[model samples]
Target: MITNLIKTFIELFGDSNEEICTFFAPGRVNLIGEHTDYNGGHVLPCALEIGTYALVRKTANPFIRFYSKNFPETGIITVSYDDLSYQEQHGWANYPKGIIAAFQQLCPIETGLDILYYGTIPNGAGLSSSASIELVTAVMLNELFAQHIDMLELVKMSQKVENEYVGVNCGIMDQFAVGMGKRNHAMLLNCQTLEYRYLPVSMNDCSIVIANTNKKRGLADSAYNERRAACEAALAKLQKHINIASLGDLTSEQLEEYKHLLSPLEQKRARHAVTENERTLEAAAALEKGDLARFGELMKQSHISLRDDYEVTGTELDTLVEAAWKHEGTIGARMTGAGFGGCTVNIVKDESIPSFIEQVGKEYAGKIGYEASFYVVKIGDGAREIAEAKEMSV
Candidate 1:
């Protein structure tokens, strides 16, 4: 893959006098702590080995050229530094464009560049693919331009691009995990304070498997924004009676006391946010004590809240989780991400992974009428420039 990416870069832009740099930014999966980031709660997420790869070089011309192997039909997109506005036709390129636009706010970009991108993440599967591309672009700019932007700042900038530029009201967890992930570890992050600690993921004799429903979600078209609005309305109702800023700040007892303050539907929304926050904290503690059972239990509880309380998980996700629960050697299974229809993260005994996949695949297809994809993922490091090779002068 690396060789092909480098070769593709040369083929697209020809030999350059300057050195070409290769950078990688990984996609992220939230092991637990769903829908809690926006509520100022704790989240557990780790970077995955699959993500986006970029080969970049500075060009003499004042025009930016972007190409992607994933979207061959779009061809090479050409834009100037002066014209950084979003265009619907740009498609996947907008992710990188938003990152560049954010960087332009900090410093002047004198020279344009040529970049080739390739991503391994399944699109619209609720994995942090957009964040992967954004962080990759940020890392490339920081190195090539010697900007020296802090990693946390890059994370923030990436989130800003997604929120203000790309127009998704997502929380900081995705960008944070992708920007600061450590190998063999998951981050326990406080979305409000941005305080974080890495917990070693010692899943002895087990593997983390992701089951994709293959049902794509367009954020704008999905009920994601509606759910966020529901939470906001719930919070506002609670604020009038109690002194709480977000549902994350409330305990189960406190929420119960203020239960009458919100509508029945709003009550369910707030309950998921509050309880999921608590579950995430407890799950971290269980992992610290090497209690996989307790951790697994918390994962199950999370899915229930998402399904019953938050009402995000559709039939496809519910079917997958229900099927996973019945399988032997399964520790736990739950829907991850925003959860209209995406993937479920499950911890299963290493020996049972094959049977688990086979059985779940068969059942899901029989019921849902489409095939599902499965991946066994490993936790990996955050974004960084990996290789720098001097181009042979022609």
Candidate 2:
């Protein structure tokens, strides 16, 4: 991936591109719990090497011209600093335009940009590509204007654009992880308080292998909202019997104490979230102590709850997890992102990753007949300045 970036960077800079700054934001991979983010629960996620890069230069004209390498198309949108709106002709540009809108809210803005974006992260693969784009754009604008916004603040602004403008009710996990992830570590984030720490990720002999299910998540569909609403209902019902505000606060025993107040199905969903949050905390500690086996056990249990209790895992996702478990030298496997089909996160022995990929792909192909896309991702630094170029001369 770094070699490919070096090739593209040389190409982009070799041409007459003016003075440019390329901002990057990483795609995140959750190590453990799935669908536990928005419920005010704990999730272990790290920034991926796969990320979005926005190559931009200051423009003389009031208009901003946008080009996408993925789409290989050009879009020219004229924006008035007086009032910024293109009448909702939303596309790849909206991700950047939303950042401009946020800048305008705080103070007077000076300039627009001519942006050429080339991204490698798979779209709709539960890898948070959209968040990567939004966060990187925000970082670009910040450096360009010297806005000096803090890290978490930038994460919130990026999230707001996705939620209010782009329309996705995602939690802070993706944005936060990408915005603040440390190299060689996973973030132990407390969603309720917005405080986080980098938990040491000991992948000395293991590889974090991701298998994309080739299925897209229909988050706007009923399933996503249904689970969210179920958690809310459980909180409301449990509040009468317990003093807790959210399921995040309730103990495992406490959750069971008020189980009778909820429908059998809702209780199961709520139970999974409460326990999963606990597992994430324990898993973080296990990783810190270099106890991979204990952490692996937590990941395996996470998949079971997501499948049986949360009811998010589909047959393909389940099959992928099962295949990884059966493969020797695999520590743990679970479905990542908001289920209904996305990717499975697996921790496999570094030497065995190749065989595990081949075997899993071959067996899954026979069962599902669809080829799975594998991504071997590692923890990378969060968003920051690209001070010195990577020696662009050929």
Candidate 3:
């Protein structure tokens, strides 16, 4: 995946690039919960095998230069770390810029760099591309300066970059998973409290297969904001009768008792949140009990709710989920992450991964005009830094 990074660094820096520092942060797939991060609910996510990698070296000038072989563009921005508003190419360089802004708050930085980045995590399949870049940048700066920032603090700093600088109203899930994910386990994150547990995901002879629908939904889109507003409206309505702050606190009976208090749209939003929370808990229990069928059933139900109530799933996402559902080797399938058009996460038997891929690719393409791309992934480790071969010169 990083063939280009390896090739280009050798061309630009040198064959061995002996002075460069490398870091990686992974994109993630949320298994059972969707759209619940901001609502103080639980989610299950893990780092993918795919990630964004960076190679960095320090510079004497208070300037940062970034190279992207993937985009065929180079970014140059000069600013004191104290004045972090400076930006280069806003598209991809924004992530590194975000980390610079975030880190300046915690550490003293003169803020000049020579960085080259290449990534394998698909850009818009709901796999936290922004978080991947930010974490990689965080690791790079930490190692370059010998700051030795703790991994958890590094994650919080990256989250601040998104929340305060890059301007994405994201929860801690993406950064946390990118920072703390362990091999073969999904991170069970309590987004509000930031307490997490590693849930071992030993899918016996199984793989997490992501079906990419090739439709990108930006969270800045009005519709996504509308969904959030709808959920907030539901919470406001529920608070009058339930004495609860959010849908996370309401039971199905409590919701039924206050059913008519909310408008139809708000009611649907609240219903999805409450049910999704319940399903997440159930799915967690299923995993603990080794009940794949129950977990799978909850996943299917989750997609239906996300499609109908949360109103996030698009036709492509629905079709991919349907294709996976119809497959023999798949235990459960759902449109994962913040949906509209993204990847469908499927729990597939390892032996059937190939046929499942082939059949689903054909079936999804037959239904939709576009062919679905499949990624067979396992949960992997979080952010890591490549120790420098020699002390770098500024």
* Per-candidate local distance difference test: 0.92, 0.80, 0.80
lDDT by residue (222-289, candidate 2, tens digit) is 38777888888888988887787678787898877779999988899899989999999899888988
With candidate 3 superimposed using the best TM-score fit, by how many Å does residue 239's alpha carbon deviate from the native?
2.3
Best by TM-score: 1
lDDT of 3: 0.80
Better of 1 and 3 by lDDT: 1
lDDT of 1 by residue, 202-295 (tens): 9989989999999988875778888889899988988898887788899999999989988998899989999999999999999989889899
Pick the lDDT winner: 1
Worst 10 residues of 2 by lDDT: 385-394
What shift in Å separates residue 148 of candidate 2 from its native position after superposition? 0.8
Backbone clashes in model 3, listed as residue pairs: none
